[model samples]
Target: MAKQALGPIRRSFAPWDDPEAKPLIHFRGVTKRYGDFTAVDGIDLPIYEREFHALLGPSGCGKTTLMRMLAGFEEPTEGDVLLDGASLKGVPPYRRPVNMMFQSYALFPHMSVEKNVAFGLKQDGMAKSEIADRVAEMLTLVRLQDFAKRKPHQLSGGQRQRVALARSLAKKPRVLLLDEPLGALDKKLREATQFELTDLQVDLGMTFLIVTHDQEEAMTVADRIAVMDQGVIRQVATPAEIYEQPASRYVADFIGDINILEGRLEKGANGISRLVVPEDGLVVETDQPVESDAQNAWYAIRPEKLRVSLDQPADIAVNTVSGEIWDIAYLGDVSIYHVKLDNGTIMRATTANTTRLVERPISWDDRVWLTWDRNAGVVLTS
Candidate 1:
């Protein structure tokens, strides 16, 4: 099959030099409503040009609704949606300088791949020669040149999806919107396509906006992610930033597996604050100072950060606890140990499975020690 053809490189309008310039796509208090229910509740965001931004959240989190509004399929009840500093209030989907790839791969079964791809251009009344050239280029770009004569039914699922992508890109829109683009593919194919899409985005240098509920997928592909919930954006940052330093307890728990320890703040003599987990009889020292009145707090620690051993390490400074192993799961790469602490609290720790044997250094029901550096745990106030 001929690979998809590359379109002419289009210069981006991103103003990296000017510090005061507005973003490429701006949502100024954008909101959408259906009767009493509000799908998007006054969201304000700025998407820079050439950014692979992902709208990540669970189903019914208003991500799809927000994307539809941006595509001009649904109008916002209030606020403005701006593209390239211009308002999108009166623009229709066909007239807008953007194209959307539907999650269903919405290709017509009766039409050949080439004809399907050329449908949009023909509707715009382009010359036959020009449409043929663009269609040929798009087929090659997507690696479907040989499949141009094949109908949608004769192609594989992945090929059909590529056809949809080619059709969407044939118009060369300013922005490309993908709605769960990889949702239909199998696990192995989805993983392969993720990188392929990322490479395509970088090569094309087009601003791409993807909506998905898969956290791992978003982390893998997006330059930055907007974690949304209940129609509100919880946090917006790079994947690493969002994972390492979440804004709140909800965010901390939602993004990944975290061990949260509830504790009370205690004032120390040196202006440093300590957390007292009375239940665990554990005292964790933190460099961050806390207010005297802030009694309730949580210490968030990733499972991998906790060090597990049969005996406590002498070099440990603070935040150490003794527990008995309750369960052990031997995943090929790592072993997940669930330990019941002396305080009756359960804590999870992951250890590397170095050898290929059934025997474990620490078996279930064995007493073990869990220790971590104070700095490794983040203090969550909210």
Candidate 2:
């Protein structure tokens, strides 16, 4: 199947950047506490309409608690949640204009797909004909029209998830809350379904707020991700920004595989900065200026940003390190080389497997040079 066109929406949509633009949902000083433990701290967040946002963190980080507050399932111990300019302080879950699709799917075993989808409308006392038409529309929207007569047990995991999504969308909610909705699927299916969910969210033009611990899933589907830790939001940014320009050491380490070398910053001439690692006698130069006043800092570089080669780079004054290739992981698309530097620090370099060769040119225990551009890594101070 052809991929859906989602680039325009992803690239051009920036309502949060506009001062005049109003958000559909606002979380002002929202805090949820159980006994003495704080699940969610005082947070102020704004989710724009038609935006696909994600609340991502590790277990017990309060990502789910924040989502529950928005869904009206749990009231905040302090602060408030507003949807479309209306406060949702005392609103019940059922009365909220948002629907939640749980990880379990919560499908009825005895009811058919169409009947399961119509359950919400029927509870609202909609006419029979209207409910039938809405069910048909939802089934078609999820491409489950052919399985309308099948029960939940008769469908595959992906199909069952679609049914759950269909039922949730049958209400035409203002916002859709997904709590690890694709957790049941295997790796390959989960990847494919991520695209499907993104396409579906765009097609419906409804706001989506998903909570998940899967970093790749959030990076793939969400327009913006709010990374939380210990009930506090660490950073909120687009996927590219989050990956390329992480705000802190925690965020830099959490999102992906990164090599952090602690060193002291030395300001150089002409917009040049150097990170001097005294322990390793390594001097890393960069074109980017250091904004922080702290001399003690860390230079964070992703594994893929480093270049591995047997030959020493022409310029060895900076951004060049010699190491022995201790290990190599041959993944299908790429190979990761774990090189042990002279200072006993192990850094990884990734190379794409572009051609099929019976024997590899690079192997273990080989003396190699890892080089990177001056602008390849970011200087982080925290």
Candidate 3:
């Protein structure tokens, strides 16, 4: 199903770039160890107020350990965790001004939706009237006010997740930590909920830190994503920057479908750099400055950025490769074509299917030329 229409996902908040803006949460040289295994390496990270930050990594990459540290469930072996300029060293999970929503809904199956949302408020010794008011507000915020009387078993997965969200937000915590909150939902619901989560975070003006292995979910909802691997952060940037200008080869391949070519950078006559790959005898001129002293580089290009043509273009010196169509996967919106070079290396390219039911422009075993602009590829040294 197509995604539900939602508000623009542009990043309206950029506190990280502002020098005067104070960090709402700071992890100073944070490290966590379980027995002899290091879960989180010594790393420093700061999250700004009211920003939706995502910790994205594969399983066993320490993303959850970081989130647990923030929520006070697990303490870091080294460094201090400061929330709003105050240390959260000894604060218990319940005492800390943060709420967490686990992958499981954790809703009360026997209780009504309203009661489930009001449970935390009542635990704080809030008056009955205030508890009702907060519960009503949270339900309305999650669009579940009409189902306040329904039990957890009576609602759908999405609804139950919303109830869990309402409960987590009812206490008005300083930050909300989510651990794979949408992992229980189906694909369509998960995609729709991503927009809703972003909208809710913006509407509530609350700080949200989510731990997720889903790359597309992070790109859709977060203002910034910290890509982690092997107990250390690889790169932290906006979704576009992280996808387009990956800091390393691992990050480029992890974020999306990427085609990487092992190449060598030749000495430049002017400021422009030239990288040559001997496998396909391809040389590309790039305006991007290469460091004076560097070795072992690779060219990274997204499949969508490459253009395929029936004949070779004039610019054979750079960014041009002709290969036979080795494979083709025709997705509804776009077609992925695998072009095999002379060196038996297959490179993937995607073309948009703009017309409905048109003749196949290019077919299997047809020779085609693939080319990209000078700046279309990123040079990765590490």
In order, the Cα lDDT scores of the candidates are 0.87, 0.92, 0.90
Which sections of candidate 3 miss by over 4 Å? 1-12
Among all windows of 10 consecutive residues in model 3, the one with the lowest summed lDDT is 1-10
Predict model 1's lDDT versus the native. Answer: 0.87
Candidate 1 at 163: error in angstroms?
A: 1.2
Deviation from native of the Cα of residue 292 in model 2, angstroms: 4.1
Per-residue lDDT tens digits of candidate 2, residues 56-90? 99999999999989888899999999998989989
Candidate 3 lDDT over 122-213, as tens digits, reads 88999999898889989988889999999999999899999999999999999999999999999999999998898788777789999999
Ranking by TM-score: 2, 3, 1
Candidate 1, residues 8-93, lDDT tens digits: the string is 32233334345886688988898999999989999998888888899999999999999999999999999999999999998999
Candidate 2 local Cα displacement, residue 245, angstroms:
0.2
Error of 1 at 99 (Å): 0.7
Q: Which ten residues in a row have the lowest lDDT in candidate 1?
A: 1-10
> Once superposed on the true structure, which residue ranges of model 2 sit more than 4 Å away at CA?
1-4, 292-294
User: What lDDT, from 0 to 1, does candidate 3 have?
Assistant: 0.90
Candidates sorted on lDDT, descending: 2, 3, 1
Q: What RMSD does each model have against the real structure? A: 3.9, 1.6, 2.8
TM-score of each: 0.91, 0.97, 0.95
Backbone clash pairs for candidate 2 read none
